[model samples]
Target: MSTAELRYANQFEIIRSEEKDRYLISQLSQQLDELYTKLFGLNNFHIYQPYLHRLSELLYYLTTTLSNRQTIGEEYVCLIQYDPITKRIPSLMRRLFMIFFRIFGDLISKYFLTTFLIRPIAEDFFHPKLSLQTIELITRFIITSIERTHKISFYLTGYYYNISKILTRIRYLIYSRSTSESIEIQSNMNKTIKLLSLCLCIQHIIETYTSLKQVALSISQHRNQLNLIAEEEKEKEKKIVSEDITSSTDYVRCPLCYELAISNVALVPECGHVFCWQCIHTWVAENQTCPLCKTNTTQSRIVHLINY
Candidate 1:
């Protein structure tokens, strides 16, 4: 061999020797085999069972090949030990299968799991016994929560982006500006206040978003309970309406603000309290607590009545 080739061969042999001496590879192979078996057994009913089987077969082939290889110095052991023509095709097929599996796994776990499955499962688990009216209320609450989260996310993202841009501009200005006393003082003060305001804004947004998300999750989790309470409430309401049918100028008292109103009304759930839409909306916006018993009003929405 030429001098350069000899040097390359020596380095390759060193790498091979180091790798062979390490027990980590053997341990990893054993662990992988166990994992493959467990996964295969569990995933027999999966739609991608064939693909999984192919992956397991490929893994076994690779593991066996690696185990049988002799760590000879400076010699490149042929990775493919079977017939060149037949083995080549299976090897290529295995490679393609592995590539596709990895791509699909990444896409499903990264995007589909969070976006489609988890949220829906949570919603369904919480809202099992829902009537049409209750469903509408829950839907409105969820939509509002999601919209609020999105708005907060967008606002924070913009704020950070602007702050980063401003910092970059400030850095450039500092490096290029002449060192005058007045300029130095002004720049320092501007940067300090800018950074402080940015930090405060980010902190406030994060806290608000976290609070909203927790409230949404709580509402989602208790959807079944909420539905039951709503049903009980509707029954009580029917009785009240029957009793008030004979009165010409009957008005339901506003449960939240205690303001007497004739229009745009909503029913406070569980407690069977009646209130105007504007009163409930303002109360929910401020305290998120029932005016009577301090029950949560986080998921409450305005219900408009249609007079037939």
Candidate 2:
């Protein structure tokens, strides 16, 4: 095989190893966090929840920077960081910088920026206002974009799984062994990643559509409410000018059934209209308004009057 092909193969193996290690670390951190919360109680865990990223990053840093030891993933893949400049393993100072850089940078990007910067700005000045779903959709899109970009870069350069790796000028060197095992593992991982990506793409599209539909519905409801208010005002003026013909001359009669309001007399509390109990009940169930005055009402508002 050509030198370039060998280098690409090594880099691909390194990427896969790093990703697998990340998954393991995440699972470990979640288990530890759950155990901690269980031990300390849920209420106390709420206070400690904000520092979850810190805990995970600290664990990652410690594992990756142990004295004279490659990270677990690196060892698994028979890989080590080599400095081309010195033709040897990376210097201690450089390794420390890389560790701190990855940890702090992730914390800032994932937590601090979103909490302090993006959310506040979005809440205050976004035109038409943004809903929680819209914000979540935006966040998901941003994450998907970053992952796709990283995948493209990995395919093109086969150098860095993480931006921190590039920033620290780190390169992988295989130890005294063939990379056949790592290559096989990576191939499987790649297939799984592609399937996951497809699922995420479908989810993103669905969420985007849902958010937009919600926004449209909100706008439509607002407009309908305003128009209804205007129409109600006009109706009120007309109702006051003309008395209800059915109840004008007969107060002890139900307008709905045109019968004496003697059996189960029901009162419309809002407009002082009277009807049979069954009549008003059925009217309110269907119309949800006073038959005479057109006032808004409900079944609960239809009070039954006692013949005292």
Candidate 3:
């Protein structure tokens, strides 16, 4: 097989193996949760829910150790982990560290800390000096950058699928299985797969860029809102301007929005006052009265003045 074909097969297998690993973890977690619920009754499951992450991690640790393998999924997929330097299984210490790091470093930092610690504190502080959400966005952006870098590297070199593997100095190698045979992908199919991978990479890049843009917008808006003095001054100025405008009849502004140009202009039947149709409709939904004159009115009686 050609180099492209080999790389394609390896990428496919690696993704499949990783997916299998996730499936196994999910199934084990669900089964354990179910067992606990059945044993302790439904009402008591809430007590166990908080410790689910710890339990799952423990289960993973025990499973890996007892099975004498890196992971059940990798073994199932005829894949084995090896230290690139020694061309042998990683040492006990290294393996243990990798497992612990997966459990503590990735799981705890990403899920546990965010859920248990950061989230509650963030909720308590309505306007924090340093926003935890901004911190989270930065953290996520860093992780995404690393993952995208790893993905590009994987595409080019067909090496590590998991970032954790790269961090732990581990790589996957296919083990011999009599029943399983590596299929030779046709040149056309290989090209198609490459094209699809490129498309996916492009999509991922677009999504990341969009997320970054949204986060930037949100942070800017949050900062603006946090400026109490500026916000108060703006509000006071707005109130003064609005009072002056409303006091004068010369200004052809909609009372609802205080805008010079009224969009979809609608007249209140009882008050003979005009407003933006949307503004009036929204206003009448809660209070069925003209905003400016306080004359009784209904949404149905509001007339849209098209040419008038």
Candidate 4:
């Protein structure tokens, strides 16, 4: 291979390795980045802080729909310019509103947005210009997001390794103690140490999350197997059940209650268990299986048996 090809191969390998060890590297990278930040007085990187806002933008939507407020982009601006500027909503009330908004958002995005809106629109006009535009937008957005995450991850990692080299070059200044170091200097060191501790906690939490996710997946599999086993057992029981022998040759009787099916409606369930309408309905409502075979059955699976 040429030099350029070899370089590209190495780059690809690095990318693949980084992706594989992304989570593991993040903790080290974060701590090192913070350490470098403290040593060199780097600006604290703050992006998308969710805690400062008591209420979300959903409040703006509510205001627009309920109180005829303008659909202003900014939440703070919307709140201030409103007629109720003098009135102050309680902290508890704001929290309650936030909770309600979260629930409503989940429900709407799950059912209404996906089922009613997105599904219909996509199904109807999937091959049209709208879909093309949507696809392009989504593709571009995804590419951009991936690029940003990659850049940040690498930058942090670089900081972690690069800081040592930088520190080694500037060690003279760091080691040289001229006078009493300011309280702020001590505070910065403390903060840096605390941040490194936090990074450790974050890594542990991530590992725990991965472990818990595996456990949850295993539990889900077991639950599904249990359901399947229950279904099979129900089927076996349904097969073992003796057909109800009645006094007359013309009519079949329900095994349960041991009586001739007097009702006009005859119930033949999916398990081939013959029963009276009311009897099967009652039985299924309780047991959800054929009385004889223990086979799985439901109200929907029950059919009417007609004799000529």
Q: For each candidate, how many residue pairs have backbone atoms clashing (under 3 Å)? A: 0, 0, 0, 7
**Residues 274-294 of candidate 1: C-alpha lDDT, one tens digit per residue:** 677777777778888766777
Cα lDDT tens digits for candidate 4, 147-205:
34434443333221112122222110011222345435645655665565567556655
Maximum-TM-score candidate: 3
* Global lDDT of each candidate: 0.47, 0.69, 0.70, 0.45
TM-score of each: 0.20, 0.47, 0.57, 0.21
- RMSD (Cα, Å) for all candidates, in order, is 27.0, 14.7, 17.2, 24.2
Q: Per-residue CA lDDT of candidate 3, range 4-111, in tens?
A: 211222666677777877787777788888888888878868777747755776687567843466676676676777788897777777776666766666545567
Better of 2 and 4 by TM-score: 2
**Candidate 1 clashing pairs, residues 3+ apart or interchain:** none
Q: TM-score ranking from best to worst? A: 3, 2, 4, 1
Give model 4 RMSD, 1 decimal: 24.2
Worst 10 residues of 4 by lDDT: 167-176
Runs with alpha carbons beyond 4 Å of true place in candidate 4: 1-198, 201-214, 217-308
Q: What is the lDDT, from 0 to 100, of the residue 129 in candidate 4?
A: 28
lDDT of predicted model 2 = 0.69
